[model samples]
Target chain A: MKFSKKDLIKLYTNLVRARTFDMLCTRLLAEGKFVSFYHEGAWGDAAGVGTATFLRKDDILYPHHRAHGFPHMIGKGVDPKYYLAEHCGRATGCCSGVGTVHALFEEYGILGQSAILGAQFTVSVGWGLAAKKNGTGQVVVASFGDGTLARGTWHEGANVAVLWKLPIVYVLENNGIAQYVSLEKAYPLKDMASLAAGYGMPAVVVDGQDIVAVAEAVGEAVKRARQGKGPTFVECKTIRVTSHGYGSPHMVDGEQRDMNMVEELKKREPLSMYEKNLLKQGIITKEDIEEIAKAAKEEAAAAEKFAMESPIQEDASILDQYLYAE
Target chain B: MRLLQYNEAINEALSEELARDEKVFLLGEGVGVSSLATTRGLVQKFGPDRVIDTPIAEAAITGCAIGAATMGYRPIADLMYSDFLYTAADDVLIRAPQWRFLHGGRQSLPIVFIAGSGGYRKVGPEHSHSPHSIMLHHPGLKVVVPSTPYDAKGLLKASIRDDNPVFYMFHKALIGMKEDIPEEEYIIPLGQAKVRREGTDVTVVAASYMNYLAIQAADKLKGEISVEVIDPRTLEPLDLDTILKSVIKTGRVVIVDEDTERCGFAGELMAQIMEHAFDELDAPIKRVCAANYPIPSGFLEKFVLPQPAQILAAIREVVK
Candidate 1:
């Protein structure tokens, strides 16, 4: 389970990149730079990055709707420029500016995400079927929030995925809150991974704040899936450091979060915690951290520039073009 | 040419497509047994890998079809009854249809959602209903409602080959109906309407089981009213051109639909006819559709559903 020093650095770099891009997008949204809504992946970076950083380019990923899948896409090695362009409604966007948050990158097995939550549970099963039929050893990782577990699709999808032993890994980012409802009020069980027991699928829980821990747990699940060992449920108990989405209240159940609790949770902030761990273990020095932070900021700046300069779609004829296959 | 029952025609199309393409697979709750008899004995030929018997989960079945299609495999998801489409509304109505378009047309979902549709089986409100109009409201889906065995086989074949999501709804009442179809491989292209009986007095546009009723009504009123029965095999890629031509010639139109009257296919067709041939109309277009109420079970269903008598009355009214 021990990652090589180089792999660790790569994971660290991806986490920083995801956080940087998310922060930039959130700031842009607040300034009205873009009209699209954003769900910040502020403290939940490791759940997406660690689970996706080691995946093969051909491996399919049904990214979680949180942060609009910025961390997951970046972890899978896709450049953020086109995705940024999509949010800006530029013609150069991945979906030709038609889909702001739902972008497709077929080469990396990044098909798209549904606006309706919990849809990935069922759709990912099909990808698993295809991978098994093709004998390509391509695994599918379907990520969703804790709130998505309440959907009926979770039961239906899990039952089949276990029955057929489809090559899929269901990663749950249990960030305590699903929009407004708290996790305690949503499900009866403390650990959502127990939901997998009804289907007899292997399940595990990992700390969402630790990128290395998430990578190790999801890495094992992905390996099992690739080896045709059926599906596995990996739950990352994480935190939502901000509101459900940008420009939304931080209240859960019509009550504001305790300011003291919010401050305490911020101390376990993923970025700073990982940086401190890397520094303590001698895995990365102060100067290395500074360089990585600077490079991520520069990359985010370049992507913003690319999106801002891209042309906006004006002609109405393009609307009918992608409606159906001729 | 060989005479085949509607269900047999569907089975033949599925068998041939499974053999024609390796990527094509069948998945449903009872696909191996196929209570509808359309998919019976398919598992024995294609084996379990292709002829998958799934849990009674509509959302998973449809979601799997969408997922498999995105990965370049054509999936035929059977919902048992088309009325059950409501169970997987997100996947059937939203995901399958809009996935390709919303993703900027980079992906094509080559999926066929086949199910038994319409009343006459007296299977209660849940099983005996044709919700094709709800599908029509959604733009991306292609809908095929075949009234005859020949059209059933040909249209189902075409739907499997299509590079988009197609809902191939076979009327439950027409399952036993038989017709002569060519033995050789054939595909009835979607969006083409068949003029079941050509006439010059009044044009009757009907679909699925209603097409059969329209033909019966035409025969019953033979000498009095010249009814031109136009069966639009595929509703989404509707051959409005053919219907308009008939409307222009006859100057009168009557639409027969098995679905409810309000916001039904009959209403949509009538509006389109008026829009295109307003001046040519000899009278206001009439429609014979099921009353706007939940289709009741038992003999009461007959009262709510469209009947040959209603088709006759609509034809007589339009001709007047």
Candidate 2:
């Protein structure tokens, strides 16, 4: 699990890309370019980008709205124009404007996201089960927020996965909140890993901020899963750098939780920490770091250009070819 | 071609598809152990991996199937009852139907949702229900309600091969009722209606179990008036050609459905006829549907669903 300079840079760029994507999406939604204001993947980039980097390119991944980074990491067909088309409910979108934020790219095996929480777990398990049955050795990694674990489908999907010994990994991006409610108020059992243990699967809580550490943990889980050792649950104890949705919420938890500590942790951002370590170890120079950020910005800009210039998805044709064959 | 009961046809189709394609697999509550026995021996032949027995999670079962379909597997997820589809409607109504369009057609959701839907079974308020029409409203979804064993087998096989998410509903009562099934494989295409009987007096459009009542009523009124029985094999991509043709020829229509009368299958049929064949009709289209109430339990359950006598009366009214 020793890190390479290329790996660290690649990981950093992914987070950077995710931040840019989220910012753009927020702006787009506000400017009436997109549909909904619900944007994920911004705060929980580690859980998404880290697990994605840990697995092979051919491996299947299931992400939710917040894990939008997974699609961008898998690469190109889902252009920014696709996102724009999706906002307009136009055919040019990845889903031809049918899906909003939860577009799936099958070419990369990035099975789409679910607006309904915990639903992705079921789909991920099924993909893993199919891979296991075929002896493909490919693993399926699914990432969900802490709020989703409260759903019954979480337990049901996990039970089936463990029972069948499916090659799957469940990553819980525990950002300490379920939409509006704090984790403490949402669940009595604080640790989701402990709950995973009940399913007879190995569960671990990791520092989500440490991209390399998160990658190493996921690497072992993916290895075991590939080896037919069954499913594993990795609870990435992470933080939400941005607001829950777009703007500030009026209601605050009455608990005397220290806001000062939260602000202090924000100063110690994961992206900065990774950059500082890479610089000190001589794995990557400040110049290389700057280049990665510049490249990411260009990529985001190109995506935006492509989305804007793409033809508007037709309104009447929305139902065209909707059915596989009429 | 031998007549097969809708339930047995569906079961035979599953058996046949599992034998034909390795990529085809079954999942859901009680499907593997044959809890309902519709998928009785599938697990034995295909083994557990192919014939999966999932925990009681409809949303996951359906959603998981949608996911697996993306990975190039044809998944047939059985919801114990269509009523429970609401629990996992996101997978069925949202995910499966819209997957292809959402993914920019880079993928196809080759998944099937097989469930026993409709009222008249004595299982009470929860179990005895019909919600197929709601799913029928979704344009992308393929809603297949087989009224007989032959159509059940043929259409189920067709659905599995088709590269889309299909909602296949086979009435519970029709499973044990035997009909002649061919030794070789065959397919009943979706969006095509079967003309069970031909007549110029009146056209009777029946869905699922109600087709049997239409047939029975036809048999009793054989000498008095001829009844053209049309079963629109798939609900969403409705076989408008066959139905409109029959309605145009007869100049009268009677739609019989086991579901509630309001916004039921009957209403849909009427709307379709009015849209395409209204001028050809001599009289207003008639409907014989279950009363707008929660399906009851016990012997009265039979009374709640459309019966042969009620269908006959409706036919008489429409023809008169």
Candidate 3:
């Protein structure tokens, strides 16, 4: 597939935006802004940003906990300040600090980003079924990690989606790690997409770190799903450069890494790789790259300033409210 | 007033609610065939879309209802048996309840989770037990246990309309039981308790099928022991004010619950009564509850479950 310079620049901006968000989260966590930090897997920026760019406001996305960049990447006119505010326990946060990092943004079609492994699959299938029933022509993208493929929920959700022919796209960011266990030990099948084959659905494997590759693959899947061709499974062989959480050093084969994998991971960095490709093709100039980085940094700075000014959630009786909708 | 069986009242309430709102739909196993009689004829009348019959995937079905509900649909998911609550615990206990608070309290999942409850039907442990206490134990849910056919219709209608996740549990053995239901449409709001029988010696607190036992036990001890029977239809938003008023008048209380004794609704009610009404009480409140063991299948349920005889004994003892 060919891409115009405009679309390519947009993708690059989103990828950088996600990276900037992750950097800010990490920096703030290190500065004791929050009690504990769980921001990790900044390496999946390509998958999160690329796939999200292809979705519409009506297209539901049940994202992973780490994909806090999803709503901000896709949603228009939405400030990144809510993400910072939520983590800072501010009243202006997405969930008034009742939710940290990830929460639902209904208007943006970002459903509650679940931390539960593989649990969003069934609900995603359900939203797909609802769209079909409501004649909305809305498709859903359920994004998760390779470890989620091991859960029965993923298999059951895929099976039901196929049986009912629901309009859904399952994106597996196969980062090769699940908490501490390696993917090879977590799943019996060599390919996560093979499970979709058993359900008679189209499945594909793509290089996850490459922005163009991830965008093109997920874009095609999303197209088929929107056309009501049932669900598609796209496995992105992603990379995880950071530890599972903040303060914890990266572990390599049960041994903590002290920059041992830095040279190797730098080669796989999505931003640098995409920048190199864009530069080689003359799609972007050196000035454009610098401008993008500056814009991302400014956005991060603006969000941090907004969060610092936002008030902490007061009202001790507030917890009593919203427990139920009433 | 029109006399109706327990299940008919539920059927009418579901039908009326479905007609009342376009968003309300029934999704669960055996909903098409109405295995429990509460959903009979709904699929045919409302069509398959509105009355969805799902496979044995309890977790998926329940989770799907949450998804559908989040997207402006009011799903009244019927789990056929309340035991299936454990299967969909992640969605029910964790997701549906927590989503509203976690998402800045902007969204309301108006889901009416209906499950068949109660024992003494000899249908076995899984089929015949009441787990309303489990719903009450969990935060973020409004638990409703309808006793009479009247409350069944009124409460179910009210639950469907309420902007909260409500566990509207119906006792299985009480399905065939009849009561006088109002001919005019009405709603018994959640959190209100009904005084079934009024007396002065003891305040008898009961719910669901246990309410029937309390009333029967109250009648048995009529002149000998004046017992006031209080039916807390909604267990979670308990009408404790009514019970407390009765407790102040009677200075005694006897609570009956179908759930086992330990950490049960009865225990919570007693604890609250002790906390709020301790100065008013003349003696320790008595709780007549199911044996602290798994309800056995078959005829053994008669021995394992709490009956009116046991309720009568507790009422007599509390008033003595």
Candidate 4:
């Protein structure tokens, strides 16, 4: 479970890419290039990116709707670009231009995200149960915001996962908010980790701002799951870097942080934090940082080009592929 | 061509489907124990892996079935009674049907939610109600109500094979009524309506066991009133063609459903007929259905459900 510089570097680049993509989306929507206004997991990027780094290519992950960072971290090659295009309602998107943000990459075992709060919980457990039955050695990760825990499916899924000792990890990105309301208003239980403890499963709360910390916690849970220790719940206490949607909703909030506070958080950015740690340990040179950033940008740029230049989905084929009747 | 109970037809369909496709499995309360008789001898045939008897957790069973379906297994999840379906509606409406659309059509969920609806032999309010009307309100969900043995077999096969999640509802009362069913496998495509009987006096749109009552009422008034009975097999993507054709021929209509009369499934049919066949109508549409209340315990259940007499009364009023 040793955390290496290369791993830290990879995780940092992905987090930066997630923020970059979210920033681009904001500009796109404001300019009307993209019709929908979407916000990334501004507060939950570290948790998403870090946990994703622990998942193998074949391991499955189901995300919440705002989990763009998670998909980018675990996506196979140029798939995330096409997926983003699809989410933006572009014709050349990953879901064959049909779905935008909730696309599933079956090849990479990214089970897609859900618009409904806790619906993915049971499905994740099901996938874990299937993998366990087939002896596939694959662990399933079901990630959701703190808001979704109020849903019945969460309890139903959690109870069954513990009952069967299924290989799954429930990731709770508790950014202290649930939509317009904060977490305290939505849930009576102050600690989400305690929520899973009642189901006889281990639950832990981690600092979601630190990529290595989030990664270490997720890696341990995933390892436990693969070893058939059943499901674990990880509650990450994090903050959203942007507003809930396309623009900064907090810009108008009188309780907004001053420029100095914003700058402080920026200095402690997930990527910068991970890079600084690796640099301090002398595990890598400055050239390594430059190469990774260059490679990540190139990958993102190529994916965007492919997605933008791809052909639009035909109108006639809309319903053709819906059912597997062939 | 022989008489079989409505429940028995469902049993036959399940047995045949499981035997035919190894991918098809049953998961529900008492399914392995053959509590509904639909899974009779299924445990012996497929064993525990396929014929799973689950705890009384509808949400878990439905959730597990949806997950299994995603892994390419065709799972038939039985809700012992239609009333119990609400326990798992989240999976049926939110997860099962919406998966493909949400995933940008990258995935398809092929699962069957089987449940018995309509008045049974005094099974009380919980056991006798039909909830397909409520389910039909949701898009992407396919609702199948089979009224006969042949239809039960054909539609059940179709539902098992369809890549989309389907809610297959059967009337407990119709299980005893048998019809000619071929041994070979065949499928009735979803979203199609069957013309049970054709006449020119008035059109009678009925679902599940109510269709049989409609047919019976139509037969009783054959010489006096030529009643056409149409069964819209799939209620969600309702077969408007057959219904409109019948309505146009008769220029009058009566829609019969076992669900509640107020904003029930019959209203959906009535609206469709009125909207598309308005110009051809000779009179206002009438619906014969269960009263706007719980089915009630004991004999009251029979009184609440739409009977042949009630359907005949509606037919007479529409035709007159």
Give me the displacement of residue A92 in model 4, in angstroms. 1.1
Which TM-score value belongs to model 2? 0.92
Top lDDT hit:
1
Highest-scoring model, DockQ: 1
Best by TM-score: 1
TM-score of each: 0.99, 0.92, 0.96, 0.88
**Predicted candidate 4 versus true structure: per-residue lDDT over A1-326, tens digit per residue:** 78665676677667766655655556556766554547656646777877786588878777655655433344322246766577556677756666555656777777665666677776775676677766778888887878788887787788888877888988888876665566766778778788887888998899888877888898999999999899998988776555567664654233553556556556556666667777898865799778866776776677556656766555666664553333
Worst 10 residues of 3 chain B by lDDT: B128-137
Per-residue lDDT for A182-290 in model 1, tens only? 9989999899999999999999999998888999999999999999999999999899879988989988877998778878888778888888888898999989988
Question: Candidate 3, clashing residue pairs?
Answer: B118-B128
Model 3 chain A weakest 10-residue run by lDDT: A69-78
Q: What share of the true interface contacts does candidate 2 keep?
A: 0.58
lDDT of 2: 0.76
lDDT of 1 by residue, B272-313 (tens): 887888999999888888998899988899999998887888
Which portions of model 1 show Cα errors greater than 4 Å?
A: none
* Full candidate order by DockQ, most accurate first: 1, 3, 2, 4
Model 4 misplaced stretches (Cα beyond 4 Å): A3-5, A67-78, A187-190, A251-268, A298-326, B1-4, B120-127, B176-192, B274-279, B291-304
lDDT: the better of candidates 3 and 4:
3
lDDT of 4 by residue, B1-320 (tens): 54555666677777888888877888888887665677777888878777877668788788887777777778898888888988887887777877776566767788899987778578888777788878877767889999888788778888888888889988777766767666566777888998888888888888787888888898899789988888888897687887887877889988888888888887877787777778999999998888878888887777787777778788889877
